[model samples]
Target: MQDLVNLKVISLFHSENLVRIPELSSATKLELINLAYCRKLLELPSSLQHLEKLTHLNLRWCKNLRFLPSLYKATSLTTLILSDCSNLFSFPEVSPNVRELQLEGTAIEEIPSSVESLCQLISLSMEDCARLKNLPTSICNLRSLEVLSLNYSPNITTFPEMSRNITELNLQATAIEEVPSSIECLSNLCVLNLARCRRLKSVSTSIHKLKSLRGFYLRDCSRLEIFPEILDTLERLRNLDLSGTALKELPSSMENLIGLRQLRLENCESLVCLPESFHKLKSLWFLYVYGCKNLVIWPDNLFSAIGGASLTGRVEMQKDLHGLSSLKELDLSGTNLENLPTTIKQLTRLQKLILWKCERLKSLPELPPSLIHLDAHDCTSLAEVSSITKLFEQALLCKDKPYTPKTLACLFTNCFLLDQKVVASPGTPKLQMLFGHMFTILKDYHQASPQRNMFTTCFPGSEIPEWFDFKSSGSSINIQLPSEWYYNRHSMENFPGFVVSAVVSFQDYFDDAHFHIRCECHLKSCNGDCPNLSCSFTVWSRRGLHGSRLLGSDHLFLLYHNELVRRFVETQASNKCIYKEASFEFYPGVWERNWSQCISCEVKHCGVHLLSAATDDAEVQPPKRYKYVS
Candidate 1:
């Protein structure tokens, strides 16, 4: 090793009891040295300064290391890390060319004023420096310094003025009681994070002058009770977070942040009211207020201004909404809201509305037709579900522009009945309309694409619809296809146009469970031999808001496989005397493992629709062996 004077890189990490480094006095070309996690390493040889070309050094986690020697002459050094050296109390003068420096988790008491000599310093972090008292005022003179982080330095009472060139600052978990008015001096600062600064009682109103500020994070500042009143001048401000704070109310100035897009106030339990000026925020898109338990009243008169026809028949109606047309998402989960304003139905472009765990909410006004997702899970107090059905009707009937359609996804898990007083009266009518809309949707789709299978699901009742050609009490049913059935075609080409329907009741719910229902078309010869053709249809189940239910759906599948029809026809032409009837078998299954417990939801009804323009109502024919008991 003594003869290897041109060595450029050396790593000797995780070595135990390596108290003294071997002599390397002659290695002048050394540019990097790493001895990280050398737990027992006591010191670096002073001869390290002989490496005139050294540019990087890493001694991170060298627990027993006491101090570092000066590197004032190592002009090429650009990266230096002396982190987690608990026993080390001070860092020597770093080279001016160094661009990044980290001294986290150390006992360093103060940053030296000489740090200003590093004209090229771009970042300086003293995170978790428990003994740090203050930052040197001269640090503001480093024209090139762009980032300064003093997180977890609890003893730091006063944050000093920083360089105008600094674009971001982090003082999280510090003891600063107030941000001094000098904050205005940082004209170029774009990001400022004072999160968890419990001692920070107030912010200077002059901070609104930071024209370039685009992001501000004040999360979990427990003692912060108010915001500055000069938001009107923050034209460039786009994001602000006051989550987990102690704010009792939001200032009217907040509504003046026209360019702001997101505002977070989660866990601000003490907040009592929101100002009516919120309607003026035209560009505000996302508003999160999940845990504000005391916030009961939103801006009054929030309906007429947004053009939402508010008909608060029983509840007093006011009008505060002025220009909230651009607002897209709003969350009011875990609040004390009892009813939604009728104006909510006016947000034409809003896509998502979340009201999870709103225990006092009893009903909702008409929802905007543009809604795509509604998360109303655990809203047990929600009673009126008629509004939801009307919402669906409105969305489906985007009648003005018939060709353009909208899709909506909703979740109502563990929901309460819309009108629990009269189960049959309320449920029956709504269920009928829901099923009716579904049928229209399917019929319209069929008109659009005649050959594609039209499928739909509904939980209206256990009894199959009167339209099904066959209804059964058990799991299996057989349909006999008559030879003349094909000869009598609805088409000139002698092709039969038919669709299959089925009804099933779900016994249990599974997150990713599958149900397999297969149709087998088979013929048993006079010799006791059987030849059959089959096809299968699968149903994947997801967790439902309500418990398991029996479903009736229009199915297009397995029963109409061309192979079965062709084989039946071929067999028909060859031997018409063997048997006049072909056996059509329907079998329902859940993966064998879950089949035993899921036997209750059998295919209660099965049938086929033979189409004809003159046949306004396809007559349902009773099976030959089955008895039709009314």
Candidate 2:
């Protein structure tokens, strides 16, 4: 092994004091070097490139690292990773054989023409390089390049000429104005994404010549006015996205795209109507027209071809969308729609329906029973809903009035039936179902809850119910009582298994006069079987405001199951202080697995007392303290 100078790995784990690379020029065998989580390391050795055998190098998550080593001498390097090195400002010169490179979340401003020398490079990514502006024209020399991703490159003005071998290319969120004419030279391209390219205005006409193209995405390009006459040339195209574009109408020639499966025109605000020949797209399965405020109807015969003869008997009008039985997901939210086509009931495959912010929608038409997720928030005109029992997993309904007996079977949390009361059905099935719905709501918006308080009394003071008290013991200490809980169940008969309880304690330790509080939590599940519950407790005690006083201990103590898991006892006075009156809300089925599992608790304090110095100035002498406990 002594004679072997070339090695594959040089892994350094948690070696924080290692400041510079050792003189390894004599060992010509280094290929891969991995420096993982070396926090205190500030810079790299300038002689790192002396190793001609080095190839792969990883410097992931080195937070304090500010610069990269010069790589001009390491001609054998092929792969490099500088991911999450937030302070890195530049890249070293690239060698020809380098194929895979990732520099995500760095300050590199451009891909130097020096990279063009890497003729063997295939996959290259510079994602989240916010300040990057250009790719050198020399990039066209990489004949083997296959996948190139430059997403979130905000300042990028142009792409190097397209490489023929490129199969997948992503230029999302860029400032490119048009697809270069040289882009059509790539005959093997399959997927091309220019989504969110706001400055893009036009596409090269040569796009019609790429016969192998299968998918094209052009979403959020608001200034783009016309689609190049390439629709008829894409014989294998399966997905096409012109969503958020300024297109007013589809070209009559678009009827030739017989193989298209997905069409998205969402937020195409100016599109008022569809062409009649749109029905020719027999392969269309997924369609999104949400936010098309001006759109009034589907093209004639559009649904007839998609639903087949099985749905022909279900609808009388060809303009009705209900006959489209093959359709899977529909997002007609925020349209000027008042009444949905009753024929929509035929789309048994529909899984999701987003009707949020549709203020004018008075009611939902009969929907397929197979629906799984429905979001109908802020529909002011909505009053009642008919049978919706099929979508058991999820349902979000923030209605003004609470009408019961429809789908009250699903457990729900954070169900804001404002000013309305809830009446639950008997048995564990209904209880379980009700809790499922409730749990889902709470988990979704728990972070936004203003109270932020984790623990609270179930019935407040003096209102503890009889179920809480064990009949035999005459005390609530045993008998498998449900811990802290939240519910509207008036009796066991209406008890839905959807709600469960857990216990936890919280307190803040003060040096002399410590303040502490503990409580239990009862949560409602949104869906799925409820689990055995536990509680979240926190104790925070500090010396003084901003932790400036030496009289008090500024330590925090947290325990679960009577075992200490976290301690914040400090020896010296710290400037930062913990929040007071910590509060948080827990998910119905999930409890603290560790000290950090608790959600952020909001502190609300009342009953603040002030001490008087005049009453007993001599008697209130300071007391000597020993070991400080967290």
Candidate 3:
């Protein structure tokens, strides 16, 4: 120890066995000491007080540390961290020059008034200090303090007056009942979070005075029945979350928030409607109001005003729905609407439309051409989906032109009415036409480009179409390919790959069950050489309580993969090698639990079909198994 007189730094990071640090009496020039994650460290050497050059002292995660020596005399210290010292019960007096002090997860009961002596402190965090009760009012005298966090301090029943220079303040899950009007004095404050403060009932209207405030969160404050009206424009405020609150309505003055971009009001059951001027927020792009059961009506002119806004609620259809030209996603789950306005087809850029539990919707209108995903999982009253036939017809009409391929995925998991009406009809002509149109689109899309796009659908059915040339009773199947089968002498399209089909039967209802069909493909050449080219893709996934209720019955899953399969087979073809046999093994299961659980499923049957553009008249053949010969 005597030979370390010139030592300037000491770091014992993660030394879990270190019980204590040697005295630093002789190392007067020591400038920094780090003992982070030294869980067995109980205390610092008292000789540490004599080091005049010590500028940084980090003791983070020292769980057994129960006390810290007074650092008031260490005038040169600028940073001190005692975070996660679970056994420490008192705040240590730090030097006036200290710029940052962290005491998060400590057992400290109260902050000493002498904390005001830290005039140069820039940040003070005491988050998750369960035993902490009150902060010294004298802390407001810290003129240089900018950030203060006291989140999860349940005993903090009153909002502490803070320094005027404060920029960010977090008091989430505290017991504060109201934000006093004096809060406006924090002129430079940019962020204020009071989320989950169940006792919070009111906020001073003076909050509008925070000219630089960018985000304000009051989520899950169940007792907050009203929000003060904004009298002036707050152009910099971008995000405001009031989800899980009890507010019945918003003040019309919200139109003054011209720069707001995201607003979340999820599960606010008491909220009946949005303000009439809600459309004035042109910059708002994402709006979520899911599970607001009483929110049955939308403002009449709301859609026409916000040109590109995304919203979800029980919409009261208006004559014109095309005003939202730039909207991309819309979720109207759990609504009572019976039908969508025909103008929905005018939303040329709409991509995803979610209607998970709209039980009263009896039919679907023709959707936009840009539609990619349509989720109507449990629409019990839906009996007509003729619009799908029109979509296929449109694709057929444009088969000759060069265009980008648009993939589509539709989920009709438990539409019992639709299944009885369409799949159970006398000859099932509609069902057959739907499958035929889908095939035409797949062929047309493959001819355009090799870009990977998938088309998948899920519906109630028990049998595979007879067109599939290869069929198996279980989950595995093998197919034989003729030499030079990929090359066609007729048209320009190289090869139109194959389609896979599976029948899955569920045993019992599973909450949040995500069904997936994985296929492992292996290829073998005529020379006995085998290349393991394995690939798997998710064929079907479903969630939500309503969607899983009726999933106990059998359902059919279909997938079309042209480009994906081509990339694999063509790799071997380029080597002047031909794969005479291809084998596939299917595994179907739910992601939520193991196969032995009460919620289980089995793949009852599997089949495959190959597509070719060489001939216009193709006939369905009998099932045949292919084997590789050495």
Q: What value does the lDDT take at residue 442 in candidate 3?
A: 56
Off by over 4 Å in 1: 2-6, 11-27, 34-42, 301-317, 387-408, 418-439, 442-630
Q: Please provide, for model 1 over 1-630, each residue's C-alpha lDDT reduced to its tens digit, 9 standing for 90 to 100.
A: 477588999888888767878677888889999888888998787777666899889888988989787777778888888888888888667678888887888789888888889999998888888998898889989999998888998998897788889999989999989988889889999999999999889999879888889899899999999988875567777889998899988888877687888888888988866777777777878888877777655676455321111134223334644456876787777765667767777787687787767766776778887775676655767766556656654544555443343444454434434323354555454334443344444334323322322122223244543334444554444544444433222232233333444555444533234455666655554445556756455443333322333333222211223223433445443343343334455676666555433453556655543332232232322223433322
Q: Would you list the C-alpha lDDT of every candidate in the order shown?
A: 0.65, 0.53, 0.74
Compared with the true structure, model 3 gives a TM-score of 0.82
For model 1, the run of ten residues with the poorest summed lDDT: 305-314
Sorted on TM-score, highest at the top, how do the candidates line up? 3, 1, 2
Give the Cα-based TM-score of candidate 2 against the true structure. Answer: 0.57
Candidate 3, residues 1-630, lDDT tens digits: the string is 576679998999999999998778899899999999999998888888788899999999999999898788888899989999999998987779999989999999999888888899999999999999978899999999999999999999999999889999999999999999999999999999999999999999999999999999999999999989999999999889998899999999998888887787877888877777776776665566655666655655543211111245434554345244555676666656677767678777677787777777788888877777888877888777868756644433433334344466777777766555345457664444466556556555444444555567777767665456667767778888656654323322434367888787876756466666776776677777765655455544565533456467877778765556656655644355555777777777556554322236777878777665443433322223422221
Model 2, residue 596: C-alpha shift (Å): 12
TM-score per prediction, in order, is: 0.68, 0.57, 0.82
- Compose the digit string of candidate 2's lDDT tens values, residues 578-612: 21121122321112233333222212211111111
> Of the candidates numbered 1 and 3, which has the greater lDDT value?
3
Q: Give the top-scoring candidate (lDDT).
A: 3
Candidate 3 has an lDDT of: 0.74
